[model samples]
Target: MPEKIDYLKKIRELTQEYFQISLDDIPIPETELVNIEPDRADGLLVGSKEALNYQYLVQGDITPFLNKAPEGYFLIGFWGHGFNSYGFYYSRVEPNSRIFFRLPYGGAYMNNKREAIRIKNFLINFFEFKNKLKTATTFNVVESMGEGFHEIKYKDQTVKFKGSVYRQRNPEKHFQKILKSLKVPTKRHQHIIKLPSWAGKKYEDMTPKEQEEYQEHLRRKFTWEPGDLKKVGHEPLTEDEKKLVESIKKQEEDVNKE
Candidate 1:
């Protein structure tokens, strides 16, 4: 609780330094950001590794919040791990006309409630200035793991905004990472299917019903059993697996020959 407050204070200080607005000038009162535990209603597994927290500050109305937020924000209430940080949205009305900004994860570690208030004050000023800016400027310092800092310039001033950075993790190269973190078996690799060149020829020659039957057979044989693929130390390949691999090789060979 104290940590949350400290975070608010820091945000307020940053806002004041950048935007020249104090906590009192901001119309909305600071409220505690609450941690909502993931539940079945949220579509999260009972013991999933991810967690979510949300905070809202309303000023004038509720209509803007609902209509203006991006699709991700709407989906936010549904999943836990998709987003892993704390942030706030400001509204001019009871529940509408709001803009949201996601804060870095560590921002939640403020000392006390009063400090959190200060941070909120800082954010409001920063955002207000951000909205008024005309050009963006890069910051000399780097903050989070994948985040970059930038300053946006307005006619009379500039405000800083944090940028998110994402890195692609390869599942094949980091199989251990995926396997170690798995709560349940992974889904089968339907994306990459190996079919023999002869199989394609046969399919083209088959009747529609025969094609349907062939497709069903493939699905039944190749589709993985739930939770089977996620296990570590799984064997190299079974007889069926070998057949699939051979078909894939034949297809590749045909393409190469062409």
Candidate 2:
């Protein structure tokens, strides 16, 4: 048990560094090293044994994890062979998903309009440079396993095609370098929970109606409902959102001047 805890701690640290996010923002989830393949003995009646190879993140839907995110925040995830590969994910107190982008490598499902645009531009430039540089790097040619098209859609960016596949024995190191280069410090605004002024009275002394209202308020405060998107692509920002973004930009500019 202690070993598993330590192992998860390391994984969280890696995720934070690779995703360019803070450790406090990451959520802790029940995890286990799952068996990926079962070793088979030649001409044997049963397989030799199960090999706990893959790092299993979660099974089925990743929505439950994303739903916990706060408004104006988005969740990022890496998509691998299966759904169990998305380790623990979390979001702020509110959530939104206006624009979504996924490469053969996965990306964030973002809500903030300004942030989505910035990341989209970054991804476009990154992949274009990578595609050009790939030919210079050593290539490992292998027989075709199967043919399938990779498609990505978000705003002005869209890609759909079937082509030669690239495989690497250990791609994690290379990916780590790319993420490190793009790493930028971000601050997540914190919320302080406080009871209403009226709630200062003792619970036992409160009126029946007041008690009922207090209970309702508590339920509303604690309950988290999943956010729904009318459409799963890019959407224009409202005037209010635009103003908020302008304010943020001004703050950043001020910080740079210091």
Candidate 3:
């Protein structure tokens, strides 16, 4: 309970710093909580590795907080790890809205359309996974192996699976297969998939920084250069990449018309 509170406090402080906020202006009141366990309701999770602790919280929908938040304060939440280390992510909501994600002590993606879509998908799947956890007959966590797994018992059968902690490749399809075998309802969490409003904005309206970020996402998504076929071998793109190329073309057309 105290851990969660401390993390939230740190997260708020980091957010203030990121936004260059003056604490005196906001006047944060003392927050009272009847049950700290409810903090996990928003996709928060706790994990331990050796002597360090990890706290993960996903703020899927930040609209409710916007009215009370200080101007230019667009923070959603954070992924806190260890006692002294924490990383925060932010999202924008107005025109040219975007979400920025930072990897732990690594690279970050800014105002990226693909990342926004990825986060949206993750939040949807994650909340549904949390919902599915409630029906399990028994749930246990294991960490002896390299990457730990969960042993979940639903009805007459037991299955072992790993949680999706912002991984690029996940066993969600496999998990869905298990849930299907258990006759689980898949459409119970439509409301939980709320992303920032106006996720895709006009290219001309985007700030210079956001335009760079958008182009970076495209570069990352479509790795092949114009003459890559001659210089280096390239594998055929997946269906998703084809769609992305088409969308990029459409965006260019939209920009030309403007």
- The numbered model that scores best in TM-score is 3
Give lDDT per model, in order. 0.36, 0.33, 0.42
TM-scores vs. true structure, each candidate: 0.21, 0.18, 0.30
Which pairs clash (backbone N, Cα, C closer than 3 Å) in model 3?
none
Instruction: Estimate, for each residue in 170-192, the C-alpha lDDT of model 2 and write its tens digit.
Output: 33343334333434223469898
Runs off by more than 4 Å, candidate 1:
1-100, 104-110, 134-148, 151-258
How far off is residue 43 in model 3, in Å? 18
Which regions in candidate 2 have their CA more than 4 angstroms from the true location?
Answer: 1-5, 27-79, 82-258
True-structure RMSD, every candidate:
22.9, 24.7, 21.8
lDDT of 3 by residue, 177-224 (tens): 767766766665556676433246665567878766766566555544
Better TM-score candidate (2, 3): 3
Provide the lDDT at 201 for model 3.
68
Best by lDDT: 3
CA lDDT for candidate 3: 0.42
The candidate, 1 or 3, that scores higher on TM-score is: 3
RMSD of 2: 24.7
